[model samples]
Target chain A: MSAVLTPAVRRPLLRRLRPLGNGPLFTVAVLVLGVLVLVAALAPLIAPYDPEALDLRSSLVGSSADHLLGTDQSGRDVLSRLLYGARTGLLGPLLVVGLSTAGGLLLGTVAGWRGGWADAVLSRLMDLVFSVPGLLVAIMFVAVAGPGLTAPVIAMAVAYTPYVGRLVHGLARQEKARPYLESYRVQGWSGWTICVRHLLPNIAPTVLAQSAINFGYALMDLAALSFLGFGVQPPAADWGAMINDGESALQQGATMPALAPSVCIVLAVVAFGIVGEGIADRLARRER
Target chain B: MSGPTGLVVEGLRKGFGGRTVVDGVSFTLPPGGSLGIVGESGCGKTTTARMLVGLERADGGTVHLDGVDRSMRPRGRAGRLERARGIQLVFQDPYVSLDPRIPVGACIEEVRRLHFPLDRADRRHRVAELLDQVGLGEREAAELPRRLSGGQRQRVAIARALAAEPKVLILDEAVAALDVSIQAQILDLLAGIRRASGVAFLFVSHDLAVVRHLTEEVAVLRGGRVVETGPTVRVLTEPQHPYTRLLLDSVPRRGWDPGRIAAGRRAPA
Candidate 1:
């Protein structure tokens, strides 16, 4: 019965979800992402055949009755392997984004909010980490940790932590200098309270955008690792491993296996990029 | 009658990078009284006000809250927070003085929560009352700081400070950024609040008219030193120090000559 329009009531849910430049492109991008997520979630139930089952009878064939996309060199259904590949494909990036975001958020807030020696020490550490290329760092860590999916995932997280840290550090510093923080200080609110409740929320949009963009990077990095045999070992289905398996078959005229996974990786990366750019545009518009 | 239980600052000194910013500043504000600290930009008015409220630590001085020496108080977090409840500061820029993420209502309630352990219903009622007191409706309280106009934001800032129920309120260039009409409105509102609350005010400003209108007494600061101090009306109309007179003449009035700038500069230092 209340006629007053609160912020929650003012903007409808659908309108709010529409990021900047809400046109056909935004619609298609969101739809593509939704389909990817859904397919990833329903892979086990919807896949026609066991992804790992070796079948010499159906090996090295094109589209047929039993196999939709066709069988690979091992006679494993390429469609099934591709579908199951989403599990590791999505999980590794998620781990990279999660670990880096958490670690970076803490270190960045500390460096940004508490200036003087804390800032100096943390900033220099970040610089030292940043000097090394992320992939190289990941490879180094994987080499030490003994190569596996988890090893590369942890390595990628450590590699990207500095990047996320730098982004959040810059943003947190900007928010720290704002007058609201001064007001909080004068009000006797603890520095931790101000940093968490006030500063974090203001800088969250940037964090969200950063994570979205980093997701694409993480996907590519993990895929590259798997391709090099550092991540997602054999007998397990992954986009990168599938591409590797399909490479030799490409010359032999069985092109579908290698090409399908490669296309999916491209689509996923592009989708994440679009979403990140849209969020950034929306934030810019809001500021203006 | 209560033996002068008011704010008193003596020999306040602060320096930045080996250079003194606020030097030996001294002032006293009786309970329910108002004192204006007026000066040009970077004249250390802000630094002085900040030190008085413990926002900035003084290099050397004594700050007494209601005759209780607060300078040597324990420097722990809880102790500092308790001291914060005794004196609150309203910052100069209202646009960035509030968290844009939170609505105005929750902002006020946040201050309330720090001082009082009121339950949900009581906090909500108190927040609504504070909103009304600050001339903002409950509807506006539900909105974020960015959604509010500059004047409304300043009022919210004031309301937040008042929620602490401070014994002494320091307004550091508080009304300096508002539009003329809004400035007048805020000044009037402040006067009304003082009348109702009897809160001692350390009103820091550059505007002579605003200082004269709001404060009972004035302290003139020049080059980080208090050059003149007296009743506002007497000091404005019949100043003692040459610097104070120069400051008064600098105000844009009818037939104010531009040549007086040189003359004033030549006055005895």
Candidate 2:
């Protein structure tokens, strides 16, 4: 067999990038995400004025030399708020995605590998979680736990777990059904070794792509929670709360306060979406 | 009769949903002996092989490997590991039989690590030896299954199975996926490995020619039952059962007619 060694085919850069949306869009999306993270990290150094430092005399002012994104209803610098807002905006999704992905991976793999009564019970639990609306769950949690990031983050994590869990369950089951896993069993390897070592690596790419998309959804969900006044109360800079605060300023003819943060939210969400879909598309193409 | 270090299976039965797939199938192999189970698709040859390896639990029967009854699925981790040491199966499809992510070397080494208490260096050396035994080398071992051709990947699968150093190695249509020339090469490789390592072989295949070339004793299965059992030469040259004759005639060769085979298949034995 080694006498006729076939060299592995190396795909060209453009061809490889095709699945990630024609190269340019994926690059732009990645670039936008990178900038958002960097801006969030450097919020204090970058912001010219304190986000909550009020100047009531200049309240509802439009963009000017002093404030690049103008002043909100409270006369606080919208640019500073938006810069600082990225921190909590990204953090909420980060926590939600991290917790949910971990929970989903463990549950899904156990169910798929065991595939008896355990599978039935875990599957039904996942279905139960999936049945409830995530937003509704978050709202309920906030209503009970009192408005805060902890309530929404925990609520959304539980609600979104089924999304990751269901995906992992189906994929884990499919991967487990493959002959290689059986081959592993025949080699005397334990179920844990096979699942963690062989099964997980094979499905990791798809799971990662799913998590990316979930990150985008989580960001939007948390922002929605904040906009409804159930997250990030007054004095704290968060994109969603900034949007709500800017609403009154919008009526007074200062649109930058509302428009700037709204634009940021949309860009961030779209960038995350594109990157996630790009990863998924690339994986699908590779498998084909 | 079973030797001190051989396999003995009696009256193995299995069913899925309502239909029985394998019913009252039985066979035995002596130490280092080679046997082949020849049957048409849906005749339960593969299922029997799976049962022998404990992949699928037998609804009823006994699989005694070296005097230890292992028909029932092992109860715990230690039991499973012990049973796994007794038999290993090389699956039909090489393409999906090995993990796509792990390099072939790591795949082979994993079994050695699991079964043997060898240190890292010794394990590495054994993995290299197994790879060499299967006509592969360091370069091939480092490569993933996706990068290798079907023949090479099959060799890797064989090496991984051999790494366990089982008392019996079952090839479940192991060479069916390869090209004809590659199939011959792999068959030759298996013959060499059996001769060198003294590992008993239970070949499950539909190809009469492959079974004839490889196995000494042969069992013919039909509708999950063994209709005939004897030496390979006798079974091929002078088949007793009409079904075995039909199977032999169905094999494509010079002056073979598929229509006649199809008609023969339609006729009740």
Candidate 3:
């Protein structure tokens, strides 16, 4: 596909990234994501105070030189908690997206290529999964297995599989219908070889775009679970849990406790959404 | 040349949803023979070609290459590979026939690797050779299908089919998509290939001129049955079947009348 591109069209780096969305907003979203990841990675070094330390005398103090963004109701520094919260905030969604995408690719490719009883069964299973709301599944799993990140993450991963699976199933089925696949089969290439070598690569970009968008949704869902006390228990400094813990602080006139993490969650989710949509737009244009 | 090495298909039958698409279609092409099956759309010419290559399983009858039965759908990898060595097909559409993401040279090399137990170096050499046979250069070999023109892609498709080293090669309207000049070039190339290699040609086409040019024997199909069968020259110049005459008259030439052809086409056989 690259062979058809003219040198003039291929020259600019910005032109290549243009498919990710309009220039300035896409760049800003990427930058926000980059900063969040960096902050999460270097939380220990960047944070000025221990996120879990309780300073009762100084609790609920407004922002100052001593403790920026003020202390939460529990006296945990809001700024430090926000930085540390990035780790769990990003990690939960990462696991959900990774697991679901892998499962989706496997099940979808098999269903699409085989296209008989296997397709019917797998498609029905996916439809069943699709019928259930992801958050409801996560909450139910949390109720059964006790509250923690593990149960909800696994549940959400299973719940999210249908979105990716259905997309991949449709795309793979369309791709399998192309004459090239039949040509390969006619050449005596095995079905496995044709799928791994030709079919997967062609559908990879679209799947990648979907995964990017799924990452954002997964993040928000996980955060909502944590807020409901079904994920990331207290003192672990999760964005969703922090919002919950800061509810009392909001009434005490220290909005930074709840407001700061809320802002961060919204920023990360919106950035991921923009990046995913941009990539999808670019891929659509390239196909056209 | 009449030895049992070439394709011998007898009474091939296929029906979709109780409607017979190909019914008791039969033909034989001896080694080095060129046979054309010509018909209008829905005449089962394409279905017959598909059955020959084992892409479509026949409902009944047999397809034999080199005295081995290959009529049934292959059971396993070994069965499929054995059948592939017997016959190969070059599809009608060039644009969608080759894998878009794969380079042309690799596409040819893949078939070579699958059919033969050649080392990587030998496979590469053979790939170059096959490309050269199809009038493509090393530069085109490294490029993807999108970079090449329709004629060039068709050439690559031909090269890929030849790499399988099959005894029978089925061209299912293989040049129908090309313009006149390119079609002439492809026809010349195919003629040269036939001379160079004794691979039997099963040319499936609707174009009377192409059938006349490329085939020695011709089978005229109508309504899922052969309406006429004879030497290409005899069939084109002095068609015996009324349906064959209608087909020939339908071809545009000097003073061709669309109205008369339409009426003739509308009339029942």
Candidate 4:
């Protein structure tokens, strides 16, 4: 007449799915980014009109049916440009995330695993890179490479990979010393399996968190480059370019141009933050 | 006396910092024969035990199992998998030994997968039988380490050690934490297991009473150095070295009858 308490059951993936939209802010932010990614992914289909179509005769006009949100200094539709801009903003961040995670995971795993001279050398170099702000690095990169979306993303990925790498390096180092890992070592497990299987699974959450933080930074850097006229060149509807154009028209009492792009940038960064925080919280709780 | 290969220690030496922890200790046992190592706290009993199973590195000396001096520490995937099948350990704190996140059934199942490569149903059946052999209910098979009592955790640890079913089982302070009565029960279980399966045991403890009751041969260590060793009963009743004798005396003789014993010895004073 005895019973046992099994270890905590692993909840099914569906059950673990959070009500991500339960919080009003998280929900609204997700919706904005969702619409943004969708707009960017299906830009060929969803954009109502040619983003760069000129209507110079009616340039700088106020909001109306012919040119809702008004025309820019050029004849391009402001709304159309905004929709088109999503491709640049979203694509830049996605590319940065991919490149940084890839580079950081390899470097961090090596540094954490080998440690000693290798860890010391890699970490110090990363520290030096991290000392410089990512935006500054992107600016420097654009100055050297010339203005382009890829240039800004690459710059950000390089700058941010160090942060993600160090985070992973620290976690990987700690995981290697755990008893289970040592036991696995004595069990004749290859170093590769120990690294790939146990080390990766445990360090994944940290890497994921780093990626989220980096993704936010990458988006902002892209936006910054766009603002400076180094990214998502003319004829494209980028948030930063929208903000840039809006700033000039500010003297003429046009505020929506600036406000729309500014809001989009904030929403995108905040969404990445929320998703990162969510993943971090789930991982931290399980560790307990 | 004979079954499979026996464990051999030839001049095994290990040190940490400036102090030598296990100094040139050596011994051999018939496969499945139980040998208890008795030592004080700072002695190298645990360290020597760890070296045999490759848990800790021995600075000098060779560990020869079946007359083969092993080189190349088993590390990484294939090597670790091979080591898991070859040797297994039972740690002191049953509370902290088995991973909390891993269930008992799954923990045992892991060994089978790594070593035996059994079918799913057989693995499940073997896991249940292992739990039963260790005196746990079938329902408790799926439980985690936290849900089990200290004795039960130790039992599960024992079950875990047996899962690998290695040629040598290194028990490092394995059952010292249990209550006196519970200690007896676990010791009995270990004895039964040794009798049935020829798993050479390097049982480490500071407890004289338990070692006397369970082990066939005894090795007494003093500061990582084996001072005296012989048959378990002889070593207990008539220890040669002063250090070994002090270790025996420290057990605090129980049930002394002052009046009855004094009456028999009277005339002296």
**Which of 2 and 3 is ahead in DockQ?**
2
| Tens digit per residue, CA lDDT, model 4, A152-252 | 88888898789778888888888776655655554455667668866787677778876886777788888988898988787677888888888877777
Candidate 2's residue-wise lDDT over A1-288, tens digit each?
553443333345545555455378988888899899999999999999898898999888777798777788888998899999999999999999999999999999999888999999999999999999998999899889999899999999999899999988999899877998889878777789888888888898999999989999999899989999999897899989888888887777878877888899999999899899889988989998
TM-score of each model, paired residue for residue:
0.92, 0.95, 0.94, 0.79
RMSD of 2: 3.7
Instruction: Give the candidate number with the greatest TM-score.
Output: 2
The CAPRI classification for model 4 reads as acceptable
Q: Report per-prediction Cα RMSD to one decimal.
A: 3.3, 3.7, 3.2, 6.6
lDDT tens digits, residue span A1-288, model 1: 456656568577656566454576766777777888888899999999889999988788898887889999999999999889988888899999999999899999999888789999999998988888887877887789877788888888888888889988898888776778877877887789888887888888988888988998899999998888888887799999889999988989999989999999998898888887778878888888
Off by over 4 Å in 3: A1-22, B1-5
lDDT of 3 by residue, A1-288 (tens): 667776667668656565354688888888899899999999999999989999888888889997889898877899999999999999999999999999999899999998999999999999999999988999899989999899999999999999999999999999987888888888888889888888999999999889988999998899999999999999899999999998988888889999999999899999999888888888888888
Query: Would you list the clashing residue pairs of candidate 3?
Result: A20-A278
Best by DockQ: 2
Could you give candidate 2's per-residue lDDT for residues B1-269 as a string of tens digits? 43495798999999999899999998999889999999999999999998888788899988899999997768877888788889989999999898888899988887887778657778888888999999999999889999999999999999888887888999999999999999999999999999999999999999999999999999999999999999999999999999999999998999999999998899899
Clashes of each: 0, 0, 1, 19
Q: True-contact fraction for model 3?
A: 0.68
lDDT of 1 at B14: 96
Candidate 2 regions exceeding 4 Å error are: A1-22, B1-5
Of 1 and 2, which scores higher on DockQ?
2
